[model samples]
Target: MMSTAHMASDSILAAATASMSIHSTSPNTTNSTESSISTPERPSGIDNCLIETASGRPVVPRRIVNPIAVAPMVDVTTSHFLHLCKIISPNYTLYTEMIHCNALVYHPDDLYNFFGEPWEGKVVQLGGSDPEAMAKAAKLVQDNGYKEVNVNVGCPSPRVQKGAFGAVLMKTPSSVVDIIQEMVKVGVIIPITVKCRIGVDNLDSYEYLYDFIKLVSTTTPVTHFVVHARKCWLKGLSPKQNRSVPPLKYEVVHLLAKDFPHLTITINGGFNTNEQIKEQLELVDGIMIGREVMDNPMFLAKVDAGYYNIPAEKIKSTEEVIEEFLEYVLTEHERGTPNSNAVVMAPLKMLYGGRRGKEYRRRLARAISPRTKSLPDIVRDVRLMMQEMDYGGVTTASEAEDNGGSESDSDSDLDAASHSASGCV
Candidate 1:
């Protein structure tokens, strides 16, 4: 019945505009003229509720009323997927897949093709080891209209390791400190956060993690962190194997919350069900979930009512979400968004999940594999597929694949587009 987020995102942008006057009716808002952007109440323990660095440059984390986030995934967490998730549940934070700082610094033009136009509620995650390069990329991201930025220290893929970032940097906490220090030093106004594993290789001790957080937070202004509660193996395991072989140590992250009461901590990895998420929310400031969301995005339909405690009436139903995403697909298709693989298939193939929706997904793959028809026609075909599903005896997609493991965003099933202004040619 309205724009996603009830158009609160659009109004927040006006604050960044020349007009000093803007009245925001977003959740938890009282009258204010300091800045038009309204921030959700941060988790209780932190002071002033602002995301700041050590030297005291503060940027109010805007619009996210709840700490729930769709964890960044390669090929999985596309801009279009984020758009669809927002239509279903507006309050949760969304993330882009890790873009190399070098890419952002150098290839700014191609990014929109790879990742649609930057939107509200979506945080950009940058991967790099150089402080100056990361700072430049952070500035570019802030300039492009994103509200926040996250540095990726949790990805354990070989390609990332080869780039000297990701889980490899856990071995070099000083390097992470350097990167953040340089980012905040430059004119990056948005809140810069870090996403990292608890430890890497043999540096898996709690004390090592304690020292890492202590050094980084004490030296830099970075106060918020997303910790994947698992020690990653830098060698001897493929990224997929690394995700499974490492045992999840949730208590380590819990103790981290207890120890660093001043900082905001969000726990990621090994979260699947709502009960589990609710239990962890009581322990940490937030939760970021991956694979499960990509597999069954319908889970987002309940986020407003379930996590943020909004009325059930405001939430979208499964059919409504399907319809909304289809209309969006048609719009983006006509707009000529080049990478349909990301804009279309990333969410479409798995929009419907579990045993009941397998047939719908199968039909989607078939309809999309051949790009002969217009996307509008394809959307109509999929709508018909949903209408004619015989879920009576469907053998489901693997239930065993849904286990809570470290997210491996290494598989980019999406391809960057050939040059075009919209990147959707």
Candidate 2:
């Protein structure tokens, strides 16, 4: 009773599973008699290097070579937001929201929920303690064109703590190693990275963190670690409180880089401006920014030109980026994705942060308020408002009247349109 699409999907999964089974044992232990497995065909334009493993199988090389990455955030770094960030800074690495392994296993159809083009430079962060579950989730990410999979052992949210994953796993170094080993075993050819806090609760010692890193590195092939540069007080603090309340011990992360020079160590937490990022780069391999980027996304407009050495002519302006994103919004609207309003509006809300942005921000908020009707209507209102605000160019009141409205009349039309939209009632 399986549909054709379901059958095809099952075949792909079966092939992947068989491939893993053939290469399941330690590459270091394979004998001459074992047949070498071929590397998967990579996408065009990706610079891939194939190397023979100890098992003699051809393996594709994967590493976090980018020097800057946007941290994965819950509910905040959705596909829409990532698309916007990509527009502004094409070279900086991006991460998907922390996806629970259980959900991925149970709801396979949800994979198509990603709402953007150009999947390159993105890492999918998965949260789970179960080694098998994490392995399956890692495979799903790889199959979906993500070049890297990150194990999120840094989230201190109470919900994650209850799930026995996230920062809580830092206490069980052995379990963390097992998770990474299984992910590698299940054919995760790309870099399997870990994001962790400096320490958790009572285990806040440099030796403790070093031990955790050593065990995982020695036992598995995980070579990249993004240290959040803070300890998580699992019992007393909320997740938000955990972010700020813990004193940032950046020196601990710097020491990590010095001690584990072979590993790619990236520092996270308390980084906002280019100056801070430049300072951290002197010690660590990379930097990850979260809340600051979300609050003032315009900051990313400088990343390509400043950090990546991309030419100024290649970088698009804020207005040009917004215009391009609105086109994407229309496409998603036509597709009729659920909660499209919230998804499309999330990044749009972050658009007006420059000069004369206060009034523009207020108008944008009202345009996408719950009172707004359909996605199309919201788009129309947003476009009109942007034109009136002289986002890309100035539109005088005389021009507004020529287009069938005065300045105040346009505002009145927006209010009336919000009520007329289908969902507002």
Candidate 3:
């Protein structure tokens, strides 16, 4: 459990969302029927726009008008990775990897050392049973410029279970309430929220969920609950399997929002298509998409242009985004403990998502191998390889362009598009 001192000291609020928005897509998309669809209006009796804390402190709603977020992947979604993703789609809200309360309150310097970045509008996901420890962790994040502190009661990993935190916390609402109270008491007042599963094992019942939400909401001003709309079978499934096998009862989550009008609820898990997000918006306050964003980063480009109704900018080629980020990474490396070349290459692989993606990843993996290739060597090798594949084995550039090839490739370009790291950034 968390100690009193930490919880009492960690409460806080936010400043503002840095000016960020998604870039645009091809022009033809805007003329399509799907493109003509309008974003639903914000809910009635719900100030669904950017909200304020109880103290009137500015709090941005978990709205992805950019409608795509970089999932809180653990190792794969660090601050550096988030910064990289921002270059591709700056409007996207980024999440911190799951921060264990033990690691957060005790080994904070070490925790921040690897994952920390001071982005003003970022969210911090925490794991712990002790209200005090969790509160302390929340405060640590608040002091560091994070916009929100979220309790991770949705991850079903055995390591997380063993620690009596993560998804397991869903089964203990009183504990969650205590943590929220401590965070509020300590002045870490930026919206404290929960990310959890519908239920655990065969114990899927509205009563369990109702009681859980009722207990916490009544006890503390926790207005946002990010529900991963799947049951987690504590006894039988691995975390990965748990994400899939359990049935998704989105209606149950919608009902939770209907039942508790004052609370803002967002649905997470298994959402891939924009149409799915559009349909979900009719029912919930926000939508959290995992893996999909990594697999197709440009997925939200259209959303920025359509749903949020902002005129989108041109989507930069992966090479362009990578080049800019590499400069940032190189500068950071020079100033501090440099990230391994492999660490840099991992996120870069997301750039190639379409038809030639497999070959692109293979080349990338090779370029960043411990036996390092020079920058010019990598650019020359990859460009030639992609160019060769584009030219039908003839190594012809004019022919590649004549084939209607897009310098900005699609999701079909990558061999494997799924992100392997846990949501950490």
lDDT by residue for model 3 over 113-189, one digit each (tens)?
A: 55656665467788888878888888888876677888887787877788888777776555777778888878897
Task: Give, for candidate 2, the lowest lDDT window spanning 10 residues.
Answer: 397-406
What are the candidates' C-alpha RMSDs? 15.4, 15.5, 12.1
By TM-score, the better pick of 2 and 3 is 2
Winner by lDDT between candidate 3 and candidate 1: 1
Best candidate (score: lDDT): 2
Q: After superposition, how far is residue 242 of candidate 3 from its true place, in Å?
A: 0.6
Show model 3 residue runs off by greater than 4 Å. Answer: 1-68, 110-112, 309-313, 371-418, 421-425
Error of 3 at 5 (Å): 19
Determine which window of 10 residues in candidate 3 has minimal summed lDDT.
12-21
Error of 2 at 18 (Å): 43
In candidate 3 the C-alpha lDDT for residue 155 amounts to 80
229, model 1: CA deviation in Å?
0.4
Q: How would you encode candidate 1's per-residue C-alpha lDDT over 268-384 as one tens digit per residue? A: 886867788888776778888876676666566544445556655566556666678888888888788766543464565554444444445456556554555667777787777
In order, candidate lDDTs are 0.65, 0.67, 0.60
Report how far off residue 75 is in candidate 2 (Å).
Answer: 0.9
Name model 2 segments beyond 4 Å from true.
Answer: 1-64, 114-118, 308-313, 369-372, 392-425
